[model samples]
Target: MSKTALITGASSGIGKELAIIHAQQGGNLVLVARRADKLNELKQTLESQHKVSVYVIAKDLTNANAPQEVYDEVQTQGITVDYLINNAGFGGRGKFHERSIEDDLAMINLNIVALTLLTKLFLPDFVKRNSGKILNTSSTASFMPGPLQAVYFATKTYVTFLSNAIAEELYDTNVTVTNLMPGATESEFAKTSGMEKQVYLNKQQRHIQ
Candidate 1:
């Protein structure tokens, strides 16, 4: 049987590319994103090209109930997940105190809370089967203290550290966890974080090649 991958934020950016890569490899997909249209479009494209099954969950990961909902949905469909990608995250610009409390909370909910919840919910199944792969998307910003984007950076640090620690704990198990640390590449992240000018100019000056 083909392996299955569940990717959060699969509608765009890194998540979207990852899904495409998995599809090309003939892996079945469970794509989750807030945009149903985009998710459906990707499903069509992948199924037509790869001839692999594609499932979509259109819901906001920031929701407290989302993790369980995703798990239950997968169970109802009799899908066995061989991989999980926690790639759903967003950043907020400006000082901690200056940013909107709601936006900061949403970032925390998605980046930290939601990620942890889903990991915990899935770890048992992966452990029981003694096999699985997990990929969590962390950022280079996780390595430093982001002044303007304080909470956002802190959340990513949590994700990276958490993933590493769990990976160590599961060292003896067949499961493998990898935290992808990607430097600023092209994405909607800048606009979403309201840091377009800052990220763009820095990229242009550094010519990150």
Candidate 2:
């Protein structure tokens, strides 16, 4: 049977690509993002091309209650999610003190809080069934502290450790948690995360990998 994947940040870049790939594999998709128009456009394309059902949930996950809301909506639809892809995140460039507290907190809300809550909400179902997969988009930045992008780096580290611990916790079950640490990629991430203006991106060509 084809699986169903619920992916966040599915309107663009890595998230969009993941949705497409799942569709290509004949899997249904529940795509969540902030832009309704973009989500609808992607939904139309994926449904027409892959002949798979695609549900769109346009939500700004930074909101304190958004993760729970997403979970409730999914439950209402009666869609069994075989995969949960937490790919929604953005970074800001600046020294820690130089960055606004609000911005950094927002980063934490989405990168850490939202991801954690969604996992907590869905993991119970997976555990009950003894099946499911989770893919969280961490970053190589998690390996060390980032001088310019402080909060973003720290959040990814939290993701890495959290995912690792959960994987071990579910070792006996088929439910699995995976962390994806991607290096520099040419995507909207560069532009939104302020990495495009950083020196490293300017020094080398960023080809899609």
Candidate 3:
């Protein structure tokens, strides 16, 4: 039987691309995103193309209880997640002190708290079953301090560090954790983070060369 994978932020960008890749590999997918329409569109596309089952969970993971709610929804539907992709994230840019505190907190909630909570809640079954895979999305920004995007950078650092530590602790187990640290990929990330257009262009140029 094909493994079932749950992916957050499945409405767009890397998350959506990962969903496509999973479907290509003959995996059933449970996609979560705040946008119901986009999720539905994705579900249709994946199912039609791959002939695989697709489920969509529309949620804003910034809510403190959202992760548990997601897990509960999956259990309600009797979906056993063999793969979990914690790819949901948001970014804050510009001067740290000048940035909106609400945005910063939301980023913290999604990028760190929700991801960790989901991992903790779902990991027990994986341990009991002795088979599972987790892929957490970190960024190259985790390596150095981001001047304009302070909170976003810090949150990714936490993700990378926490994921690596857990991976080590689960070393000999059947569970495997992988972190993908893309170096400023071509996505809406720069725009959402309020990065300067020129800076984004420069980065894109460097990425291509």
On TM-score, the candidate that comes out on top is: 1
What is the Cα-based TM-score of model 2?
0.95
TM-score of each: 0.96, 0.95, 0.94
lDDT per residue (tens digit) for residues 26-113 in model 1: 9999999899999999999999999999999999988999999999999999999999999989988887787889999999999999
Query: After superposition, which runs of candidate 1 have C-alpha atoms over 4 Å from their true positions?
Result: 203-209
| Candidate 3: count of backbone clashes, pairs at least 3 residues apart or interchain | 0
Which stretches in model 3 have alpha-carbon errors above 4 Å?
196-209
All candidates' lDDT scores?
Answer: 0.93, 0.93, 0.91
Q: Count the backbone clashes (under 3 Å) in each candidate.
A: 0, 0, 0
Model 3 lDDT tens row, 1-209: 99999999889889999999999999999999899999999999989999999999999999998999999999999999999999999787678899889989989999999999999999989989999999999999899888888889899999999999999989989999889998867666666666668576887999999
Clashing pairs for predicted structure model 3, backbone only: none
RMSD, model 3, all Cα superposed? 2.1
Clashing pairs in 2: none
Per-residue lDDT over 82-135 for candidate 2, one digit per residue giving the tens place of the 0 to 100 score: 999999999999889888999899999999999999999999999999999999
